[model samples]
Target: MPGFLSLRTKTTSIVALMVAVTMACGGVMIWNTYRVDRLIEGMVSDSVAAYQAAEALETALVNQKGFMSYYVMDRNPEWLQRLGEYRQLFRMRLERAQGFAGTAEERDTLASIGDAYDLYVAAKDKALGLYINGDEIAGGEAHAGVRDQFFKILDHCEAYKKAHEEELFAARQAVHARAEQLRWVTVAALVFVTGLGGVLTLMLGRQVLAPLRRLAREEAGELALMEPNEVKAVTHRIENLIRSAGEAHTELARSRENLLMAEKMVLVGKLAAGMAHSIRNPMTSVKMRLFSLNRSLPLTREQEEDFQVITREIGQVDTIVQNFLEFSRPPRLAMQLESPSTVVDRVLQLLSHRLRSYEVTVEVKREKPLPNVTCDPEQLKEAFVNFMENACKAMGGGGRIVITERVVSETDGAGLAEISFADTGCGIPEEELEQVFQPFFTTREDGTGLGLPISQRIIENHGGWIDVDSVQGKGTTFVVYLPMDSEEKK
Candidate 1:
């Protein structure tokens, strides 16, 4: 007993170890599954409920506006009653939204919305009272205040809902990434365990058999010393091991579903890159042919116009292919420390002719003594040009474009060089704002839709980010934040 572990004792110990490991693994899997499920459920519930509440509030406000308009125009008591109903609904929705606030910022926004709504309601009521009592002039003046309050409420709601939606989207992306990592870990665990089990089985078999073979060769003495209790203990351990293995196998099977999702993503990226490369040569040849034909053609006005249209279409296709190639095979950045204001001024100078043609006014405001940013000057200028051109196109006729630059601290407290392009042009719609950064998404008929995406890529390559804020029918602003140091290079 002091010098040796018997074959029966060794087998029993190994079996118990396997059982304990399997049970511990199963417990961890269960706990992790539960935690992920609970988090996903909470995010979905809170996001859905918050959005619904905001939508309900907006709908109630719209209804109130319609009913108020009807009452003002026709002096209808029924319309007033409907207005009151909508007013109550609005208050209820506001309270529900307040309850659903997911963050302190959201709570503050909701409070501001509630205050604005209350003021609007008060102004509306006073206007209605005056109008009913035959003071149209006073009622009109009071109603103007209601409009201002209403706009403020809308602004607050929009900001609150937009922030929450972004947060929810980020949370969902994180959950997906975590789930993907867990899947890979589980697959790796299974493979490791299978290999380990096979090795252990072979080593244990040799160890147990070698002892038995030596005992058999030696004499009947060792065989006679083997106890019935030891055999029984070994048998019990084998039974437990069999049961644990069966349970572990079942749990692993359940966890192994959809193992190819990450593989599919990798395959898709390679496929896209291949497809883009394949299309580029053909597209360039077609464009060259079209240009050659356009120059060589001698035709009537109608024929020339038709040829020009075809040539333009071919050019557009080439541009799209070029964009695809650019995206799939990005050029290496030539980084250098340069003044952001200088880049902005150069881009503005290059676009001056186009801006003049479009009747768009350009203004540059630089916070003096701003630190130089590390970036590819040419690429940064390209990004600035894209933004300026986008602003001009958005305006259509004429507008003011303001380029502001300053050194600022990023969200992570890192020093950043900030440049903003604010334009008095038609703003992006709320629903479409987030999608603007996505490749091949555009609102314009003639747009290739890769400008913003390419600009975003360039900025991100330089270790920066772009932030956009827009209000429909008012204007749009794009802020680019680049690191002051070449940390990305390091």
Candidate 2:
């Protein structure tokens, strides 16, 4: 189906074309009227010319009368000569009037008028001849007849002139009225066409173009909305990426723990080797003393003193072996509710020798009513020992170590207990800080690099997490977060 404006335009064009054709025909009618009016003008002009010519003829006839009177009354032959000129003038005018007669009827009427004029001329000529022959009564009677006929011809000429002029005027008025009517019709049609065209233009714009434009605008708005939605989709994808990053971080942490366990085993093997090297001389002396004692010789005081030295060396070797075993294979937990402060205090006791040797100052701040945490006693002890030793090592010669324990309320559905170990030592470098908990990645050559990694594992296994804060050349802090006994629900 066609649109509203298209239909309207079709209707309007048809009407306009029809009106234009009709106006054109009206113009043709005006032309025809003009031609008819011209014909009437020609007829009117001929009639007026004929009437003037007839008047000239009448004046010539009067002059001939005067000439005849002079010929008859004074016997002047000159008058007769002049009479011929006057008669010739009157005949020429009569012939010219006859030439103007148009149609046969008009020509017959003009011929009748001409005949009357000829009769007047003939009578005048007769009168002049008679008067010349001295027949006065006959001459006067002929003159009177000629004058009557002359007046009758003149009256006929005037009547035709008046009739033709009236016809011309009536024709001109008819043509003018027709023309005015045509002009008014044409003007009305043009005005109608202009008004229709304007209406159609406005309707077309509103009904067709405007709607298309509105549709375009709506499409643009939809496109604009689509763009933002696409951006939102991109934003959602980005959020998914961030969540993936968090999961990846957790997996990476577990991988690091496994690596740390491997590295710890390697370090243990090396430590065992070093311990063997360190005890070799002690063992040799102990062996030599034992061998000598077995030779069945009497024991001397110096020899016995040597035996005691051997036994003491053996005891030192045993102690070193115990320490190595402890650090090498820390036991898995049989998790239970325990105080974090108690675990930290045990680690401090275990590292007391080195802590004293380095002149390290230590501070312990614990919540008076700290929440109970669930973890293995020995495993937690091992994790704390690693943290304490690292703190002491960072201090180098000496620095303050602050150990704090606090009960944290669940704010975001997580843990409720925290233990913090802070040391005033040269902090780890910013770039290296993230890698500190990675197994086998350490700044110090002597570092096994398993301490932080292992500690992180133990804490995570106990439903906890570890965080580190450090500034190069300043200090380092390690915080262990553990859920309370009641918070194990998490």
Q: Give the TM-score of candidate 1.
A: 0.42
Best lDDT among the predictions, by candidate number: 1
TM-score of every prediction relative to native: 0.42, 0.40
Best candidate (score: TM-score)? 1
Error of 2 at 87 (Å): 99
Q: Which lDDT value does model 1 have at 466?
A: 98
- Off-target runs (Cα >4 Å) in candidate 2 are 1-330, 413-415, 487-490
Q: Which residue pairs collide in model 2, if any?
A: none
Total clashing pairs for each candidate: 0, 0
Residue pairs in candidate 1 whose N, alpha carbon or C atoms collide under 3 angstroms: none
Model 1 per-residue lDDT tens digits across residues 1-490: 2228775676676566666666666766777788788878888789868877887777777777656667879877999887788788888999998899878977888888887887788888888889889898998898888888887777777777677778678878877877776677667667666765775587666876555544444443344346334344444555667899999998786566334433533554565577567875777787788778778977789988887788777777767666666665678999887888888878978988999999999888865735677779999998999899999999999999998887777567678888999999999999999889766679999886779988998999998999999999989999998888745222
